[model samples]
Every structure is written in structure tokens, then in C-alpha cells.
Target chain A: MTTYKRMVLASRPQGHVVPENFRLEEVPVPDLKDGELLVRNHYLSLDPYMRMRMEDVKSYAAPQAIGETMIGGTVGEVVASKNPKFAVGDKVQGMFGWSEMGVSDGSLLRRLDTTHIPLSAYLGSVGMPGMTAWYGLTQIIQPKEGETIVVSAASGAVGSVVGQLAKLRGCRAVGIAGGKEKCDYVVNELGFDACIDYKAGNLKEELAKATPNGIDGVFENVGGEIFDACLERMNPFGRIALCGMIAGYDGDPSPIRNARFFLTMRLSMRGFIVSEHMDLWPQGLKELGTLVATGKLKFRESVAQGLEAAPEAFIGMLKGRNFGKQLVKLI
Target chain B: MTTYKRMVLASRPQGHVVPENFRLEEVPVPDLKDGELLVRNHYLSLDPYMRMRMEDVKSYAAPQAIGETMIGGTVGEVVASKNPKFAVGDKVQGMFGWSEMGVSDGSLLRRLDTTHIPLSAYLGSVGMPGMTAWYGLTQIIQPKEGETIVVSAASGAVGSVVGQLAKLRGCRAVGIAGGKEKCDYVVNELGFDACIDYKAGNLKEELAKATPNGIDGVFENVGGEIFDACLERMNPFGRIALCGMIAGYDGDPSPIRNARFFLTMRLSMRGFIVSEHMDLWPQGLKELGTLVATGKLKFRESVAQGLEAAPEAFIGMLKGRNFGKQLVKLI
Candidate 1:
């Protein structure tokens, strides 16, 4: 209880991330000070955005400082508390990095009621990922009834919710995933109208077939050739909510070959970070929580055991190895 | 005067357009029917958008059919009239294609007043090109008072007005053009804050120096390495009004290499054709007309002498040979 394990960014990745990029160390958990609470982290969220922060470049936020705790979202319970506002047994969500325990001042911590939703759901469906999907779909894409929407990385945390929300709005939802397994799960379990397996090597043809009426809205997560394929079939005046480009996490961005479509189709594309739009988080979270609690929106997770496995999990997630929302489970 | 000269699409260009792609033909003028009027074309607009319609590809509009008079905008005088709405010697604007004379049913004809504004200005500053610049700058880029806006092809019809309009809105306007002459015109004549000569072989560095604050808004007319250079220095939440990609007129679009910036900077990019938004035209044209009429907006023209010179002028315009609004004066 006095000591816990955590991972720190040892070095920035050259091209692709490797195990050596992260260093795991056992450290003493700090004692809670006045107006402070100690959180024993349960699960850490591994997202593509962290890779962006790892780079020593100008981005939306400052780069993740080298040799510092790797930034992440964690869902856990308060083990010790001195603040009157927080109880010791209360479950909470905070950006506590990739660590087994963290000390916070309750300023950034959100108390979680895990009666209907599970604690891990805070890191996936009802947390930042869910809010990202909701904001992009509702605000950017704005799909109308009977319109067709294409969701890239359909099995990932953010994209899973985007398709579900699009379907809820009475739009035809199509998903683009990596393999046959993920594609089947997207269509059969997640209720997408159609799913294109990008790894099948016929992405352009399959995507065109899936989107016969052309894509009205796109919730793009994995940008590369996959995105180019989507752009080729985009309907006139289509809206693209560019959430992530996991394909470019290695510092080199994939070129958009179908740039002509942007002009010819008169498309509107906007890239956004969910944290920047906090005003809509409450509304988005409420809807996402309801769907997850009612079993209407199903989400799958791939959890790697212990803090030491985070680096590999994150690297694998970037390469499309992870089946769903990648998380590090710290017990 | 019974027979008038017109240019028609002879063949589709493979990669680059040549004079052989167009054929000049002399045809007898048709007698006007009831409610129809005859227009003696004075000026024909030659624009980059015409190059797009030359290819038989899927675009916002249909391809320019072979052996048909090439699509264009013209300002002319009503030579004869059967419609009560028109009269002899009345100056008018219409989509009369690349012809010395045209017959209109008065449906598409717009009466023009040459009191303060010249007839030729209707095809440049107060015409489709001007409206295009207005829509992209005001509706899409939406530059703030202190924001920095960059215009490409800065001496061309659309770009010349884009910079001038941006300046009128109190924005810092930067321009990118091919030669010293166009660059000088963009800065000294058009009132852009700075102009980068892309042909100088140091576009990236020159653009960086010109836009020290980074680009907040981009009025993109030429999409190639120049557009890529602008994307590199775009500020956070930058907006790009993708108006044209003249570099891609040969059918191959240039790829966007800095696609990662789209996400990291949280930018908004929209590709638009001005003609599609008919609702905003009247308001936009009124403002543009006032600017030109009051001498607040100034323009330049690269005029070809006659209808037979259009094909070569258009080819030259595509290669950045035209200094300003390229037009063919068929008197």
C-alpha cells in the first residue's frame, strides 16, 4: 500500500514506439497533504493522442516532458482523503497518468457513481472517448435522418460510440475496421449497417460498395489510405469530423491523395480535441452514460495487466493490434 | 455581322492543355424567339475553373462537352430584343460561353449599370470571381480583425479580391504568387501586407517570414507545394477556404503532406464553389459592387485581343503567365 509501480517516458520514439521508450519504476506513493486526496488507480486509458504529446513539437498542448509520468486518463477509488468534500470510498475519474496510485487535490477529480455504469466505463464509453465521439458526430458531422455515415477505427473507443450515436439519430451507419473479426463484431454486435475490412486489400471497392449512396458524414479516426478511400466516395457537401490520425502517430503523416475531392465535393472538415469543448461534455456524457447503462451501446476493451505493460499495449494499439479500447488494468 | 466567332472544346487534354484542345468556329447567329434577346459579347472571362470542366471527370458540375461552346461568363450589350425586359444598347451579364454573340431568354441575363463601374469590371471585381473571393473569405475563412490571412495566386481574379477584401476587414493579408511582378502587384497594388514569390525556390522560408504570427486564415486558390507551405505555418484553429486547385487542373491533385497539423492545430477547412450558395450572392455582390464603385477595391486585367486568342490566353493563365484577371475582349 505504501509503494506502487508507474511508467515514465524514457525517450521520444524515432518512428515507431518500442518498449525502450518507456521506463517502469517502483516508487513510494505520496502521503496526502491538507485538502488533498489519494487515489488508488484501477484502470489507465491508452489513447492515440498520448503519442502526439510524446513528440517534442508544437501541438495543441505542451509535449509530455521527458522522464515524466506518461499522461493518461485513470478511473479509480479514493484510498485516502483529507478534503471534506471527498469520501475515502468514493470512485472517481482523473488524469492521473500511467500509475498505480496518484495524489490529487480534488480539483481535477470527478466522483463516479458506479451503480449503473462500471468504473472502467469512465475510461471508455462515458469518459473522454465517449465525449469525443459525441462532440464530433453531433457538432461537426450533424448527420440527418437516412444519411449514411462512415466511422473509421470502428472498434476503437471513440469510433465505437460515433457509429452508435449516428444510428441513434436514424442515420445509416457503416464502419471501417482492420480485420474480419472486428468488422463482424461491428456489424453483428454494434448494429452497424455494413462494415468494411480494410486489411482485406479491397478497401476502395468494399468501401464504395458499403457506401453506395456515398458518405454524408465521416467520423475519421485512422487517417491514411483508409481516409483517402473514404474521401473518394464522399457525397457532395459531406462533413468530416477528423478526430484522430493513428496512422500518423509515428511522426510522419500520411498524405491525403484525394485532396481534389475536398474542393469538388465542397466538403467541410474540422479537427477538434474533446477537452477544448468542455461546455458540451455534460450533455454528451449524460447521453453516452444512458446508452451504456441501458445496454443499447456496447463497447469492448482489451486490458493489459499491470503498469509495466502500458508501453507495449499503446504501441500495439497504434499498429491496430488491439481489438478494441486499449486499457492498462492496475490492481 | 450575321456570322459570329466562337471557341468550342475540341478535345480533352491529357495532362496539359494545348491550343489544339480548343477550336474556333464561325457560325450564323440564330434569330431571337419571343421573350429572347441577342447579346453582342464584349468581354469573356477566362478562369482556372474552366480547366476543371475540360476534363470528363466527376466534379461539382458536368464536364465541358466536346464541340460545344466552352462555358464562361461574359459582359455584353443587348444588340436586339424581343423580351420587354431587355432593350438595345443595354449592358448585361450572362453565362454566354466563349462566343462573340449569344441569345438569352432574359431568364439568365442580368442588367448592368456602367455609371461608376465599367462593363469589364463586371467580369472581374464585381463578377463571379469577386463573389467567390467574398464567400470564401467571409463565410469560410471568417478572418477576425487582427488575424493573418494568406491568399494564393494573389494576382488572379479570385485571389486579388480575396486579399483586398481581407485588408478591408482589418486583417493582415499575406499573398503567395509565382513571379516578382505578381508578388509586387499583390503587395503594392492590391495592398497585401506581404507577398511571397513561390518561384523564388524558398517558398517555405519566405512564407514563414511573411507570416511571422502564423497564418490564421488561408484563401487557397493554387493547391500544390504553395498550399503545403501555408499549412505548415497555420496557427491554432486556422481556417482554410479551399476555393480552387489550379495546379490539379491536369487531373492529378497534389497530396497534402502536413495532414497532422489539421488535428494538432484543431483547424477547420471547407472546400466550396461560390455558385452553389446562391442565397448569399446578393448581399455579397452589393458589398463588392460598392467597394469597386467607390474605388475602395482596385483590379487588373490580362486581356487577350479577340475570340481566336482565348485558347492560348487560357493556356498561359494556367501557367501563371496572366498577371491578373485573364480575359478575352471580343469587340
Candidate 2:
């Protein structure tokens, strides 16, 4: 057996998570059983929904208790295999948590074939976040031709895919992000028609200019003042896919001021958990993979150095610090 | 041609419509042309949409012009006909406006065959208001069985029908009205499971008691602070049909609190004008009329005497003073 470092939740956060909320512990790795396989973590993905799980509130996902390892998705390589489905040196993606090495029973894991794409892409462009954007835009919102779509957190994992998909459907895609840098990245790299900086002054005016014909669809990720501003700009038959309200995950609830929601705008807003649409993942990945291979879709990643930097990376990502998919390199 | 007394818009009110906003004038009776019928108004249905038409702001319908007669739905008798399709005594319902007599070209009118129901029933139970409830419940909200539904302005024309239809579908129906009298009318006459009076204290507590499993469907007619209270008790997958915001119709733009709209609840809220669903009106009216004739549904009308009392009836209906469908008796 070998020893590996794992970060556990030390305390629950009140407003924003700090480095002190996580504790690094050294533990000996377990031996693989009859049905289990031993794996070494290669890349760990940090997402916004993790912040929601940190709080002790009723949510779609279970809350991460103190003294438990922080839950996340990880791309890893099998070091030893006892299961027939996986072999040694097989790259896999699973819910391996925040650890350098772990043993899995192949229950929540998928072995990736290297002939398809890079193993790291399994934690990104063809991953859960990517499928979320695909199913939400294609099935839920179902944007028609000549419609205008607005997406929040447009430079992140899910939002980037949503913008590209909107553009592919012959609709004008507008992105809203925090800083000018991410806004530029969304417009220049992701092929979004326009981008708005929510950190700048006058969100309503900016949204009015970005969506002159009024918003036909909104891919809502960040909820707060931005959500309210988008609500005001929705047309008569607008559709909204409620992906994530990251701005309210930290618990300081922002006031919503759209009184005319019951009259002026006709909206169909639906909150979606990715697990409910898991059955379509294989098909979604295949289509998204084709888009990526043909240069129709693009993705970027901001990698943190080691497991020790996971806490800071998560905090920075929440504060709009990362440029793309925030990941921690565990090798 | 003979002359008739008609009510015309003299001036637009700054806040609420009064006697001065309307003027009684004697005008030359309209002459019937080809495919035309001369109708003598027997009953005029005063509605809340007239308040919206009085303002110069853009809405679903055009604003009532100064010196032009106020537009409304009326059940009238065909006094003369230019074509052979109709006799002199045929009862019909049309967009005849606030007048004792008018000419119709068979456009925007429906002949009311009163063999199955009363003539006044066309103005109340099986006409525009009835169709509004049917389409709002069936097409817009689409409430399923075993769901808790709530309706505001519960004793009014549209809401009473909505509550009864909900009950017929095996769903628990709760209502919000103005006073104890209307609350009694909503519960006893309309067969709503429970009723809450907005004038009563502790609206939130009363709502919690009325909707123990949370509100799955909300048919909103009155919007204001009452809308805020209902937002708190909405379930995960709630549907709200924005029929009318009577509480905000007087141009009192107050901030509505809607913080719970995005995070946990999935709401499909859509505003609709009844005319938008005209293609399906025959099916809806047939179904609703069958329900009423077979004793499965019940309705009540609060009739005020004379054409000059239309403004007072409208103002009273806006303040929740009427018991049921507010109508003006012209004959």
C-alpha cells in the first residue's frame, strides 16, 4: 500500500469559504478487493455547485459534512485492477473526491478509451458540465432560429458550451461575466455575438444594449442582480433554463425586483439537476466530441499545481478568478 | 337613423377612473351594411381590462381614445338584419362597447344559442371569462391530479371558474379573496377547499395552513403583496398562469419580492390575453358549458342597474367590492 494526501472539510463556511475550512491529512491507501480497483488521481475539477454542498441547507445534493473529504469529480489512471471492466493504465473519470489516490468499486466510474480523446477532456468538454449545457439548451430552452439568447457566467465550463451551441442553432448569443477579461474571452474565443460585464456599472442598460430585440432565452447560472436584470429584458414567450444560481450559493440572498414578471413577460423557467438527465450523457458526449474535433466548439482550462492548492483554487473560482474550467493537477 | 345614449371616454384618469373620465352622449345610431346586424344591448359585462384600455400605455389591447365609446362585451338582441342568416330577435354576444344600441358586421361576435343555458350565462359562464379560466388552467398551468392549487381574486369571474375546475380534477384548491363575504362565497358557492381573506391579518400563516404541501399551481389575477406571500409557499415544480395583475393595474408600481423564484422552485409563468387562444375557444366553451348545465359547475353575477353605472361597477370591481362577475344591466 502507498500513502496519499486528501483534503477534508474542517468547517462549514458562513459567507465565503477560506483555506482554513479545509484540512490536509495523510493516510495509507487501501488494497484493491475482489471487485475494486486502485487508482491514482490525475486531475480534480472544481465547480460552483461544490459551494452549495458546503452549507448545511436542503439542496438537490447532500451537504458535505465536516470531517468528510470534499466531494468532486476526478480523472485518474488505474494502477491496479481487480475488476474485469478496467485494466492497468486505463484512464478513467469518476467521483473520486479530493484525494491523490483512492480505491473504487467501478460503481461511479467510467473507463475512458485513449483512442477517443485526451483523458483530461473527460473532466471537461465531454463531462457532466458540458452535458448540462447541451441538454439544457437543446431540450429545455429549445431555442429556435433568429432568437436571441443570454447566458450568465459565460466564460465558465457550462456557459462556454451553451454560447457555442446557441451560435450553432443560428441564434444570436450574448454572454454576461464578471470582468472584462472573461467577457473578451467569451466573445473572441467562444464565438458569442456579444458579452456584458456585470461588474461594470448599470446592468440593466448594458443588458438592454446587448439584447435589443429582448431576450428569447436565458441560460441562468449566476443569480442576483443579474438574474433580475435579465428577467426585465425577457420577451413575451421567453424560456429560461435554471442551471445554477452561483451568486446565491454563499447564502447572502440578493433581492429580486421584477414585479412585472407576472404580466409583461411570459417565461418558462425550469431548475435542472444534471443527474436527472444522465441517461442522455453518452449521446451528448458523442455530439459534443464531434463539435470539438471539427473546431466548431472550443474549451480552456486553468490548472492549479497540487492537492494543497485545491481550497484556494475553489475560493478563487468563486470570486471569478479562474479563466475557464478550474482544475487541480494531482500528480 | 335613431339616436342612442352611449358612454364615451371624456378624459383619462391620473389614478382611478371617476364619473368625469366618462361622459354620457346621444349619438346617431349606426346603420347596418352588408352582412350587418343591428343589436340592442341587454347586458354589458364590465371587466378589469377596461382600466388598462383607459391608459395611453402600450398593452395587449389598444387604449380607449378620448371621445370614443368605451369597449366591452355585451349580450344583445338582433333588432334588424341586412342578411338572411339572422332573424330580428336572435340573442348574440359581441364586442359592442358601452352603448344601448350598435351595429355589427358579423365580425368579433358570436351568436349565443340560449337553448342549453340562460342568456346571461353567455356573458358570465360560457363566454370570454369562462374561456379565460379554461385555457389558463388547461393549456397554461396544466395542473395534474394530487397537486395543491391556489387562485387569487377567488370570488371573481375568472378565478371562481379556475378554482372549480381544479376541484373537478381531484386537486386541492385554495382561494384568496378580499373580505369575509367573498371568502364565504368562494368556499361555499364555488366549492374551493379553503379560502384566505387578504384583508385579514397573518396572511402568511393562513396561507401555510391552507397549503400544507405547498402550492403546485397558482392562477394569479391579483398581484401585489399577496403575490409576495404566495411566492414563499411555492413547491419545487410550481406553475403560475399570469392572467391579470389587478392589484398593480391602477399604475401603482410597487416592488414585488421574488427571491424564491430561481433557486429551489421551477416556475413556468406565462401571461396571456384570452383572444390569443381564440382558435380553441369553441372546445373550451363547449366543455365548460357542459359542466355548468350538468350541475358540475356554478357561477354568480353581481348586476348593477343602468348604463350610467358602468364606471362605478368597474371601480367597485377593481376594489374587490363585487361578490362575483360584475355586470351592468342595460335593458
Candidate 3:
């Protein structure tokens, strides 16, 4: 048996999750049974949704229990395989948790072919985050050409893909990011029509200038004040795809008192977990892969080295320290 | 030309409209121009929408002017017709205002055929109010069979029709009205599954009792604490067809805060003006007429005797004194 380091949730957080909430421990490597494979973690994805799992409250996904390894999606290499589908040295991506090594019964893991794209891209641009953006924009919001589309957290994983896809569809894409650097990346790098720095005092005015005719579609990633600002400038028959509410995840839930605003605009706002749309994931990946290969899509990763840094990377992502898709290189 | 007494908006109301806000004036009857008809008013429809027209502020419809005759829909008889489409003694329904007689260009009037149904039924059951309920339920909310639907202002014109339609579709309909009498009318006379009297204490608990499965569809007419109660009991993917916010209309401009509740439930709340759906009125009227004639739909009218009593009926409706659809008879 081999030993590996794993980060486990030490306690449920009340407000913001700190390092103390997680404990890094050296644990015995789990034994692989028949039909199971052993995977050595290569990269770990840190997502805003992890914050929800850290809470003990009921949500779309099950909460991580105290003293259990924190749940996460990871790109790993199969070092030992008793399963015929996955051979030794075969790369895969799955909910393998925040660990250096793990034993899986081949339930959640999908065999990743590195010949088509880099294995790390399987956890970033061509993975769940990319699929989330595609399904939300195409299925839920269904934005039309020349329509003004707004995405909160625009420089982040899902929002970045959403903005780029909106632009590719001939729609005017406006992004709301935290700082000038991320804003510039979204507008200049991603070719978005406009990027508003939400941290700036003039969110309402900036949004007005960005979308003169009013926003027709919104991919809501960060809710709260941004949501409030977006509501004021939405056009009649606008659609809102509520992918996440990261702004209120870590903080105390702020009361949203804007139902009348939504009513008057006749907006259709819907929230959905990405897992609910898994059937369309292959189609999403195929399109996104083509875009990435053709240089029509761009992606960035804020990679933290080693598995021990997963906690800090997660905390930093929640605090808006990461520029794009936050990941931890565990090799 | 004959002289007729008309009610004019002498002043805008700060809150609920009072008799002092309206001025009674005798104006010379307008002569019928080419393509026009002189209509002698019979029954004036006293609707909640009239209150919206009284405000100087912009809304879905243009506000009534300070000295202009008060706007309303009326069932009338054609006394003189310069228009070929209409002739003397023909009964009709039109935007005839709160007056004994008026000349219409035949553009705003629809000839009422009493052979199919009663003339006043054109103003209530198969008219704008009926169509509003039909569209709100079928197009906006679209409740499936066995779904629990709740409607506020349940015994009022729009709500009464909405509850009956829901019942026809095999859905459980719960209503909120003013008193035990109106509540009884909603359940027994109109055939709602259950009815809650807002005058009764513990609104939230009462709503919970009425809607044990939670509200799948909510036809919102009154929007204050009742709306708050409905929000608390909304099921996932609930839909709200917002026809009016009568509760807040007379009291405050501040909208009710139900955004967070809506987001969590992933609710679709939409506000629509019935005027936009005029093209579908024929189909709606035909279907509703069949329902009423076949005894599947029932409607009640609280008719005031004269034009002078219209103000009192309207005020009573606003104060939750009217049992059902309120109307004024001038003939």
C-alpha cells in the first residue's frame, strides 16, 4: 500500500471558508478491488460550486461531510486497472476528490483520449465548465443574433465560454468582471462587445452604456448586486439562465427584493444544475473542441502547484483572486 | 344633438379613488362624423384596470388626462350610425367611457350579438376580463393536470374565471378573497378546490393548508402580504401570471420583494397587458362561451342601478366590498 496526502473538510463553514475549515492529512492509499482502477491525480479543478458543497445545508449536490475528503473533479492517469475499459497509463477525468491518489469503481470517471487534446484541457476548457456555458446559452437562454447578452463573472470559467459563444453567434456580448485586468481580458482577448468592471461604482451607468437597447439575455453566474443592476436594464421578453449565485454562496444570503422588476420586463429566469443537462455534454464538447482547435475559443487557467495547495486555490477562487479557471496541478 | 352627463377626472387620487376626485359635467352629445356611430350606454364595466388609467404616471396603457372623461368599457345600443357596419338599435360593447351617450368611430367598438349570449356577458365572462384569465392561465402559467394552482382576488372578475378554467383543466384551484362570504362563493359557487379569506389571521398557515402540495401556478391579482404568502408556498418551477398588484396599487409604489424566493424556486413570473392578445380573442371567446353555455363555467355580476352609482360600485370593488364582477347599468 502507498501513502498519499488528502485534504478533508475539517468543519462546516458559517460564512467564509478559511484554511482551518480544511485539514491536510497523510492517509493510506485506498485498495483497488475487482472492476476498480487506481488513479494518480494529475490536476484538480477548483470551482465556485465547491463552496456550496462545503456547507452542511441541502443543495443540488450532497454536502461534503466533516472528516471526509473534499469532493472535486480531477484529471488523473490510471496506474493500475482491473477494468477492461481503462488500461494502465490511460488518462481519465472524474469526481476523484482533492487527493494525490484514489481508487475508483469506474462509476463517475470518463476515459479521456489525450491524442485529441491535452489531458489538462479535459478538466478546464473542454470539460464541465465549457459544457455548462454551452447548454446554458443554447438551451436555456437561446440568444438570437444582434441581441445584447450579459454574463456576470465573465472572466471566469463558465462566463468566459458564454461570452465567446455569444459573440460567435453574432450577438453583442457584454461581460461583468471584478477588475480592469479581467475586464480587458474579456473585452479585448475574448472579443466581447463590452466589459463592465462591477467593482467600479457606476455599474448601472456602465451597463446602460454597454447595452443601449437593453440586455436580451443574461447568463447569471454571480448574483446579488450584479443581478439587481442587470434587472434594471433588461429588455422586454429577456431571458436569464441562472447558472450560479457565487456572490451569495460564501456571504450571508442577501434578500433579493426585485420581483416587480422581473415582472414588468416579462423576463424568464431559470436556475439549473449542470448535471441536469448531461445528455447534451458530448455535443457541447464536440463544438467547444472544434472552437478551441480553430483558435475561435480561448481559455486561461490559474494553476496552483501540488495537491496541498487545493484548499488555498479554492479559497482564492471564492475571494476572486484567480483570473480564469482555477486549477491545481497535482502531479 | 343631445346633452349627456359624463364623469371626468377632476383630480388624480393620492390613494384610493374617491367621489371628490371625479367631476360630473353635462356635455353636448358629439355628432356622428362619417364612419361613426352614436352609442347610447347601457352597462358600464367597473374593472380594476380603470384605476391604473387614473394615474398620471406611465404604465402599459396611457394615463387618463386631468380633465378628460374617465375611460371604461361599456355595453351600449347604436342610436345612430353613419358607419355602414353598424345600424340603429344594434347592441354593442365599446370603449364608451363613463357617460350616458357617445359617438364612436366604429374603430373601438365591437358589435355585441345577444343571440349567442347575454350582452353584459360580453363585458364580463367572454370579454376582456374573461380573455385575460384565459391567456394568463393557458399561455403564461400553463398548469398541467393535477397541479395545484392558487389565485388571489379569487372572487373578483379575473380571478373567478381563472379558478374555473383551472378546474376545467383538472387542476386543484385555491383562491384568496376578502371575507368568508366571498371565500364561500369562490369554493362553492365558482368551484375552487379551496379558498382562503385574507381577513382571517395567519395567512401563511392558511395558504399552506389550502395548498398542501405547494403552488405550481399563481394568478396574482392582489400583491401584498398575500403575494408574500404565495411566494413561500411556491413549488419548484412554479409560474406566476401577474395580472395586477391590487394590494399595492392604492397604498404604495414600492414593489413587493419576492426575488430571492423566485430564484430559489426557479419561478417564471410574467406580466402581460390583455390588449396585446386581441388577435386570439375570437378563439378565446368561442371556447369560454361554450363553457358558460354548457354550465362548465359560471359568472356573477354585482350590478349598480345607474351611472351615478358607478363611482360607489368602483370604490366598493376597490375596498373588497363587491362579491363578484361589478358593473353599472345606465339603461
Candidate 4:
């Protein structure tokens, strides 16, 4: 009998999430029933959204219950199958959680081809994060050519793609990343018009100098003071696509000081979850997949080894310790 | 030649708009030029937006410069006309300000007929406030047939029309007003499903009980604490049409304590000035005008008799002293 290790929620997070809040358990792999396939997870997606799931509060998605497997997205190979759709060794992606193996009935599993891109890219650039950038930009911000767009968390998975996509659409892209190194990479490698180091304690002045014409569109990922600063620099009739508030997931963040600008500036802001907008996924994926496959779109990942590193990796991402898309690589 | 009473901004308001900040002066009205019409002011419209114009700060419109006429909308009778578009004894509306006589170039003047509706109704329900309600409700909120909608300042010009229109569209209308009397008017007279008195100090609990299905759409006029309260009670995928933030006009209102709810609820909020949406005015005004003429839509206005009462009336209106759309009779 084959066996593997998995992590489950031991208790709901109170303030900050710690490793002990998660319980690592070992269990034997279950036998595949008819139409069921067994997936040995090779890569697990660790995101800031997981911190929100740890709380027993209302959110876009249901909270992760105690004693239940930690909810996440994963890419793996079908090691055994009794299904006609998913044969053994077929690459697949699903909500496989923080487990080494998962049994699926092919309903939730989507077959993947890694011929053009790497397997891990399925969880980062061409997957949920990539699709998020695509949908928020096209549907919400809709940056026009020669107009300026500001993106927060500019070195991270979603923001990196957002800024690059803004550039490709013939707009001036300004990025706000945590460190000097990341900001440099965002400017040099990502081809953003300008990258501001948010940690430099001069966001307002730096952003103003970078976007002299005032920002017409903003793809906001990191909310809090960073968002407030961006709000101050927005031009008339600006649009803000609020994808995440990673700063407020752990605790109650300070009020946005410049929200009053929404009125005077005739601004429109919408907070969206990519999963809720399933209608746009097909079209978004087609564009995002082609960009990633052809290497026209670029992305970077900070991968941690083994499923056990998920908790640490996730926490690090929230603190901006991860330089890019944080993921856990399970061999 | 004719002489007229006028109020010019003497000094910018410090905290509250006092009479001294406005200097009452008499000036000889200039002769009408070609393509110009002389209007003897009948009624002057005072609104919160005027206060924004008085400040030196940048706003959607230029600030009311010191020693210049305080800009405002007015309804008057054409006393003389050099333009074929207007003739003597014709009723007209334009931005004539706090003056007894105005010389318009005819470009900004719109001829009015009060045969179907009251002359003042054109300024309140069928004019700016009414159009504001229509655009915000239909374009931004877009409540479904059975969805619940909440409107703030529910007994006032904009809110009264917002709730009634919502009801006409087959949606449940809930209102938040200042006092028991206004709340009663909103529910009993306006046919709203429920009205919550915000002064009662149980907004969170009261709003919860009022909107059992949760709030799907909101016509937000009051901001600060009330907005935060309403935000906390919003359902997932809710939309807020932020029409006004009257609470923040004078000074710093309390910050929205629950803005994080935007992310958790997947909400959309847009702040707009109805003047910017001229494309929809024709359609919106047609609907609003028809409703008022048929007695299906109701509105109330507090008229401060003569131009001298304007400053005090404006100050009173800001404090919620006036029950509805406050106006000044200047004839």
C-alpha cells in the first residue's frame, strides 16, 4: 500500500498564522474507484488568499474549516486511473490542497499540456494569477494608449503580469514593488515605464514624479496606505480594479484616507475575485496562455521544496519576502 | 438700466459658512448684448456642491473666486431678449448665481414651461437632484426586480426620488434618514419597504434587521459612519452608487471603518457627477419628468425667502436642518 503526507488545519488563525495552526498527518493512498483517478501532486500553489481562508469570517470564498485539508490549487500527474478521460501519467490541475496525492473523479481535473511552458507555470502565469491580471485589466481598468497605469505589488505574480500587460497595450506602466532589487527587476526585465520602491518611504513623491500626467487606471493588489497614495495621484475619471487587500488580510487595516477623492475625481472602483467571473475565463486564458507559451509574457517564481514548506511560503508572501510568485514544489 | 442685489464671496469659509464670508452688494445690471437675454431672478437653487466650489482646493469645477458672483443655478423670467431663442415673459433656467438679475448669452439658458409640473419642481425633482437620482440608480446600481436597495437621505430630493423610482421598478426600497419624521415620510409617504433612523445609533443592528436578504444596491448620499455601517451590511456582489458624501463636505468625516468589506464582498462602487453623463440626461429626464407630472414621483423643498436668507439657509442645509432640497426665493 502506498502512503503520503498531508497538512490539515488544526485550528483557525486568530491574529497571525503560525505553522502549529496546521497539523501534518500521514495517511495511506486510497484505491481508485471506477471513473476515479489518483493524482500525485508535484506542485502546490501558495497565495496570500490562503490567509483569508484561515479565518472563520465571511469572504469571497468559504472559510477553511478546522480539521479539514487546507484548500489550495495544485498541479500533478495522474499516477493511476480507472477513467477514460484521465489516463495514468497525464498532467492535470485541480484543487488538490496541501497533499502529496489526491483522488479525483475527473470532474474537477483539467488536463494540461506542458509542451510550450513549464509545468509550474500552469499554477503561476498561465493559471489563476495570469487570468486575474488579464480580466482586471481588460474589463475594469481598460487603460488607453498614452494613458498611465499604476500597479501595486509590482514584483509579485499578478501585479508583474498586470504592469507588463499594461505596457503591451501601449500605455505607460508604473509599478510599486517592496524592495530596490525587485523594483529594478520590474523596470529592467518587465519593461515597465517606471518602478517605485514602496519601502523607500517616499511613495507619494515617487509616484507623483513617475506619473506626471496623473494615473488614469490602477490595478490595485496591495491595499492599505499604498492604495491610499495611489488614490491621491489619480486623474479625473480614473478606474481602480481592486483585486486583493493583502495588507488587511491579517488584521483591520487603517481607513483609506483618500477615498473622498472617489467623488471629486469621478472614480470607479470594483473589487473582484477571478473565480466568480467564470464567463471571462476562457477568453482570458486563451490570451494569457499564448503570451506565456510564446515567451512574450514573462514571470518569475520563488519555489519552496515540499508541501511542508507551504505554510512558511504563504506567510512569507504576505510579508513581501517572496520576490515573485511563491509556490511549493513537491517532487 | 436696472439695479440688482448680489452676494459676492468676501472671504473663504473657515469652518462654517457665515454671512460675513458673503458681502451683500447692489450693482447696476449691464445691458443685454447680441445673443444675450436679461433674466429677472425668480428662484435661486442652493446645493451642497456650491460649498465645494467656494473652497480654493481643486474640485470637479473651478472654485468660486473671491469678489466674483457665487455660482449657482437659478430659475427666472426673461425680462428682455436680443436672442430669438428667448422672449420677454418666458420662464428660463441657467447658472445665474445669487443675483436679482442676470444677463445670459443664451447658450446656457433652457426655456421652461410649468403647465404640467410646478416651476420649482424643475429645479428639485426634474432638475439636478432628480437627474442625479435617476442616473445613479439606473446606470450604476441597476437593482434587479426583487433585489433590495438602500438609499441614504431618503426624505431629501435625490433620495426621495431614488426610493420611489426603485419601487416603481419592482425592487424593495429601504431608506436611512435623520429623524423619526423623515423616516416615517420615507416609509409611509414614499412607499419604501422600510426606513431606519440613523440618529437612533443602532445602524448596524437596524440595517441588518431592515435588509433581511442583504443589501444588493445602495444610493449613497451620506458618507462617513453611515456609509461604513451600510458597507458592513452589504451582500456579496453588491453595488454602491456613491452620489454624495455630505458628511465630508465641511471637514474630515470619520474614515470608512469597513472598506475591507469591498474585497470580501466583491462590491462595485462608482462616484459620478450627473453633468458628466449628458448622454443619459435625455432618457433620465424623460422618465423623471413624466413621473413628477403624473404625481407618481413626490418631492419636497424648503424655500428660504429672499436672497438675504441664502447664507443661513445654506448653513442650515449642511446641518440637515432643512427637510428636503433647500432653495432661495429671490423675486
Query: Can you give the lDDT of residue A120 in candidate 4?
Result: 90
- TM-scores (chain A) of the candidates: 0.99, 0.97, 0.97, 0.98
Residue pairs clashing in model 3 are none
DockQ of each: 0.89, 0.42, 0.36, 0.71
Order by TM-score, highest first: 1, 4, 2, 3
The per-residue C-alpha lDDT of model 1 at residue A39 equals: 91
Supply candidate 3's per-residue lDDT for B315: 84
Model 4, residue A188: distance off in Å is 0.9
Highest DockQ among the candidates is held by which one? 1
Candidate 2's docking class is acceptable
lDDT of 1 at B2: 87
Error of 3 at A298 (Å): 1.7
Please give, for residues B131-238, the per-residue lDDT of candidate 2 as tens digits: 888888998779899899899989888999999999999999999998899899889888999999989988999999999998988898887778778878888767
Query: lDDT tens string, model 1, A135-220?
Result: 99999999999999999999889888999999999999999998999999999999999999999999999988898899999999
- Angstrom error of the Cα, residue B282, model 1: value is 1.9
Give the residue spans of candidate 2 off by over 4 A: A1-3, A10-12, A16-28, A114-116, A254-256, A259-262, B8-26, B54-58, B64-67, B253-263
lDDT per residue, candidate 3, B139-215, as tens digits? 99998999999999899889999999999999999999988999999999999999999898878888989888889
Model 2 residue pairs with clashes: none
Residue pairs clashing in model 4 are none
TM-score of 4: 0.97
TM-score of 2: 0.91
